[model samples]
Target chain A: MITYDDEVVCAPRAGTLYDVLELILDRGMVIDVFVRVSLVGIEILKVDARIVVASVDTYLRFAEACNRLDLEHDVRSKTVPEMFGSPVAKTVGRAGARRTARSLTDKVRDVLAPEHEEAAEAEARTRERAERPRSRPAARPRGEDDRPRSRPRRRTETEDE
Target chain B: MTAPTTTAPESAPESAPESAAAPKALYVYGIAPAGIRTPRSRGVDGAPVRLLTEAGLCAAVSAAPPRLRPRRRDLLAHQAVLDELAEQGPVLPMRFAVLSPRTDTLLTQLRSDAAHLTQQLDGVRGCVELNVKGTVVPGHFADLVRRDDRLRTLALQTRRRPDYEANVRLGEAIALGVRREARRAAREVVDRLAPLAVRTVQGATDDEQVLSASFLLRSADEARFREAVAERARACGDRLALSVTGPLPCYSFVDPRPASPAGR
Candidate 1:
């Protein structure tokens, strides 16, 4: 006779993509012989994800939430439930903190969601090209060569070491 | 950045010329000993998955994807494949986007590395990885302000003055106090839980997330482990919010090599 609340509280939560991002990206076996493609924008994504944690904006939000506390109330009575009961205090605390948290979530969402509109447009262009097969040798070989050149010489140099 | 265009005609040639040239490389998910059933989960880019057996081990892989990105669906697909494999037996999961240059290289690597890989797999068999993360709850700031005279005085001064500068100072102090308490609780949680695990690996933590650790535990002990976590979560609920993820594949516990032959 397990209660629903017990099940809710005790069950292990399914991990989200954000939860396992470090594991998939940073951990696991990579043999020396394999070439790890330099993923574009990965550095930006990692930095952006952690940026909100220590920002001055976050500090100010904490202060604002603390300011809403009713200092005159008896300290023992000021439990988390009581704090939740005050709509004004709850709203103020959430409003200040939510902005930074929301922005971080949005950044993660943008990084993870495939760019469907852009993919569709690219597909249309490819379809058009396929329809006119004899127009030109595809400009792709040059692009592939350019991709390898764009990789910094320094990265390969370090791998040699 | 936008997704890389993967439709290049030149992309085909590089993967095409090798013997058995299938116009695709193998996107490896993990390596397990021969005889486990193939995973039903879709592979990255929605390719159907199959196992390639050599020596005594089999590598679970899909047709190499044309340009890999950290798209949400693909990441989940990678995890799903490993998760299904882990259910059957021990698996050595590859990092995301590890492509074997050719089928020969993959088969050769498997044959040569079979002993090392099998020993590593045996080490993690019947165990699971449990990742615990804790973030500051921020609800305890009221108690913090009440307990410390310095913080109390600062709050009183801010209330009296109520200027932007005063408020900022007050806020910074409260933020520091909250983070300090959360970190302390995080240490206590780890201390209590680490003994339950065979190995503990700490992950990066910041001002917001005070605890990020993965624990490897025997499957039989998972219930007791969860009970311990729930108890700790209750004990520190006001100051820290803790979440447990897994009974997952032992991502953190696997050794890069099972000790050098000469212990190098």
Candidate 2:
């Protein structure tokens, strides 16, 4: 019974984290003073990574998904998400757009904010030496140091090292 | 939505800093100042990328045990960490699953690259990333079919015959027409957006995600960019849906993962 319309609850559009996500985790300053921790399961992210909805396939899929959404039965037209069982799959095109928009606004607030700077300082070396190199690069552009943030100050996380 | 403290909900309360542990590692998603929140979501492996600030700047990082690889939950985790960081300022995002072998090395790298890092940070100071996507809307086919006389006659003839084989052929033809239109529209999108971008990067495109692109713009450019997007939407609304997202932290322009002498 759930169709793409139900996506309103999950992703409103692809612009959510899906759009600028490449920018946030992949861009910016890499100070020579701090270490970047490697994340686990980052390689699988690339191969299985589903692109945001913006394709003809998506249009057809959307049409098909819409077709599945019984528009006829509403005594008083129901909210779109209510039509779909799972409204939050992180990949729904429309839902992603709304979420990404909201997230960007929040990022701006955080950046201009001089308040949280202290908290960021406290954990400067916190995750040092978590994991290391074994996988291919991310589907998104990432700064060079993909090593586990938990890596110690002495060596890289690659087992070979 | 925001990850400010370790106690934040997304990531499990991670173990302490593992500076000396062999298997221990730190996960750095992006850099920011010390004033922001610790994202509620953790990085890949569900290990939180917490804030680590020094010399006025902060790094969002997490603890890693060892031998990390890509997994479904982990990819989401990486995405989540950066998601939280974007709320701060321009985050120098790292690729997914990049692990540093040691803390000393990381700190040293950050220090060595401090000037460059600062410059990169400044580069995106008041800027954010915006991704404007344009997809071929199937509705355009109606117009295309009407405009093409050869196709119109063929369609009329097919309609008169009205057989399963005929329908399939008609549908196939329509699909082809749609593809041709989509490809043309894609070229047009790149042409239109390229001039407005301070930096432009192409993103991956699948059947569902078409016209994948990222643009870095100054904060003030938000208005002009939106105006351009609006104009594009009006111009191509029938054939494509042009949607713009952002005014977010500059995440695509940072890369100083200084390669070690041997790796380079």
Best by lDDT: 1
Query: In candidate 2, how many Å is residue A1 off?
Result: 36
- Model 2 over residues B1-264: C-alpha lDDT tens digits? 333333222222254445553333466666665578888775655564556666566667676534455443454566667656776665666665455444444555565555666677777776767776655444345445555666555566665665555555555565566566765766677787778778887766554345667788876776676666555544443344455665545555666454333221
Tens digit of lDDT per residue, candidate 1, span A49-137? 45545545555655655666556653322333123222212212221111123333542243223244345434534553464332111
Scored against the true structure, residue B97 in model 2 reaches a CA lDDT of 49
Taken over the whole model, the C-alpha lDDT of each candidate is 0.64, 0.48
TM-score for each prediction? 0.74, 0.56
Task: Estimate, for each residue in A16-134, the C-alpha lDDT of model 2 and write its tens digit.
Answer: 44444444445544433333444444344333335233334333332322332223332222111111112211111222223232332332233223244435422321322122211
Tell me the TM-score of chain B in each candidate: 0.89, 0.74
Candidate number with greatest DockQ = 1
- In the range B1-264, model 1's lDDT, one tens digit per residue, is 222223222123363365553544577888888999999988887878889999999999877667777676787889999989988878888888777655666777877777888888898898888888776666566778877889988988888888788877887888798799989999999999999998999998887678889998988887788778767765665566666777677878776433323121
Q: Which ten residues in a row have the lowest lDDT in candidate 1 chain B?
A: B1-10
- The two-chain DockQ for each candidate, comma-separated, is 0.13, 0.10
